[model samples]
Target chain A: MWSWVAHRVTGMLIFVFLFAHVLDTALVRVSPEAYNTVISSYKNPIVGLGEAGLVAAVIFHAFNGVRVMLVDFWSQGPRYQRQMLWVVVGLWVVLFVPFLVRHLMHVFA
Target chain B: MSTIEAPRTQFRRSRATRSNYELWSWVFMRGSGLLLIALVFGHLLVNLVLGEGIKQVDFAFVAGKWASPFWQTWDLMMLWLAEIHGANGVRTIINDYAEKDRTRFALKTLLLASAGLILVLGTLVIFTFDPCPTGAATADVPSFCQTR
Candidate 1:
């Protein structure tokens, strides 16, 4: 139940992020100065931390997405979905840990 | 949270309906979700990791990427897929939570309208981007432009 809720929440959050991203990026066609100014606003520590949250959401959504695909596609997969969810969690950690180290270092540096 | 009006399970649709729309929608969500991870990660890898990260993402950086047919297609897919996926997801949520048919219809209409507008604009700009417009100040241009 939590996984389902998390997936829905993360999907919505990423969609919101995508909308904001496109709006700021579209500013390039309007005025480079405007675009640069908006993009740089993201450089603030608050926004950087928000970006970290964005990264975590994306990572979990993507990994759990794969597990969802497997459950839908693999033979006998739905029968073992609980285990598959655990596998998704394991993969998320493996993929996220290294990226988090470098990403946070870059963000705070 | 309102016991005044009970939440809906789904839009008024027969469970035994022969149409495959919901099935396709479910498949699309999983399929598109898989594809989005690749497209999104590749995008982040190039835009945030390849160079100076977000700081380097300026007019010239954008101009350079849109210059390629590959990047244009990549972005186009991301725009369409993510918007459709999100809209569908929201439609599902609305069907679940909305107590009134009119409210559900209104919200879904708003969702699709905005998604459609963004997709149309995004596609147009990606394909027709003018890297160097005449009459623009050189300082405002992507530094690579010489005669702007």
Candidate 2:
């Protein structure tokens, strides 16, 4: 139950980030002044924290997406669904450590 | 839950060989996801870890990145993959939860429109971004924008 919820919530979270990223990045086409003004606001601690949250969401969504792929593509995947979930968790942690360190360092620096 | 709970001796093997929307969607998720990992990680590494980290990601920084074909293609690919992947995922959620057909249709319609709008606008911006344009006042331009 939680896995389903987590997958959905993370998917939505990453989606929101994607939306904002595109819109903000598109500001480049509008005018340099507009783009610079908007992006400069992201320099603060609040947005840094939000970026950290986004990283977490991406980690979970990507790992779980692989798990979903496994279940969808592999004929025998459903039989080992429980095992696959554990593998996803393991992979998420392994992938996330470096990102965590980098983000924390930048946020506090 | 399947509306019909009857045990069917036959599976839709015939439909398996033919390419359809659902089939394409399934493949898209896996294929796009594989690409997304590379694109997203490269993006994070370049934008966040390289140079002065987040501090270096200002207007000129973005303008420079987009001026290159590589970053443009990368950003475009990321935009399409992430948006479609996200929209498809939400479509799944809607199908699972929305008992009323009308509600599901409305939600999906909204999702499709928003995703389409962003995809179009983002793609256009990526390809057409001009750091310095003709006839624009120097005062309103970014510091990096030199007068012609």
Candidate 3:
């Protein structure tokens, strides 16, 4: 139940970010300076933290999405759905921890 | 009470107007979700984890990557797939939560308009990108562009 909620929330958040991200990236076409000036702000600590949060959302969504597919497609998926949820959490932690550490280092650097 | 139609029964609605849109959308969500994992993970690793990380992402860095056909295609595919996937997800959320018909219709119209604009604009930017625009300062453009 919570996973479903998390999926919806994270998916919505990512979609919002994607809307802004594409616009920001479009600045590259305007000019290199235009793009760079906008992108430079991304290095700010606050924004960098937001980036970290975004990465966390993406990682969880990716893993949980696979779990969803399994639940829908695999014959045994219903029986193992609980186990799969744990696996999704496990994978998210394993991936997100490394990403956060590395990304924070870059952000603070 | 209305009787629940059995699976695969003929529709009361005309076949011309009705299609398995939701089923295809469901399949697309799963298919694209898997591909996006690969594409997005690689993008994150290359952009955020590899040497110098976010600091390395400048106009020059972008110019450098897009110079290669590989990254251009990679990004192009990522953009289309991710945008469509995200848009569909939002559409689903709107259907679930917005109780009023007018409110749902308004929200979806806005969503579709914005998504369409972004898709067209983003694709054009990627394809029409200039690695070195004429008259830009030497410092702002990629190093390779300086030679031209």
State which candidate has the highest DockQ: 3
Write model 1 residue lDDT over A2-75, tens digit each, in one string.
88899989988987887777777788778767777787777766886787688788889898888778878999
State the lDDT of candidate 3 residue by residue for A8-95, as single tens digits: 9999999999889989999988888899999987789999999999999999999999999999999999899999999999999999
What is the C-alpha DockQ of each candidate?
0.52, 0.53, 0.85
Would you list the rank order by DockQ, best first?
Answer: 3, 2, 1
Query: Tens digits of per-residue lDDT for model 2 on B1-148?
Result: 4687469757664545545789788888899998998898899889887777787777667766876798989988998988999899889988999999899999999989889988999989987888566655565445566734
What docking class should model 3 receive? Answer: high
Which docking category, incorrect, acceptable, medium or high, applies to candidate 2?
medium
Best TM-score among the predictions, by candidate number: 3
Cα interface RMSD of each candidate: 1.9, 2.3, 0.8
Residue clash pairs of candidate 3: none
Arranged by lDDT with the best first, the candidates are: 3, 2, 1
| Candidate 3 C-alpha error for residue B122, in Å | 0.6
Alpha-carbon error at A33 in model 1, in Å?
Answer: 1.1
Put down candidate 2 lDDT per residue, A6-107, tens digits, no spaces: 989988888877778888888777766777789878878899878877877787877887888788889998898889888888888887777777876876
What's candidate 1's DockQ score? 0.52
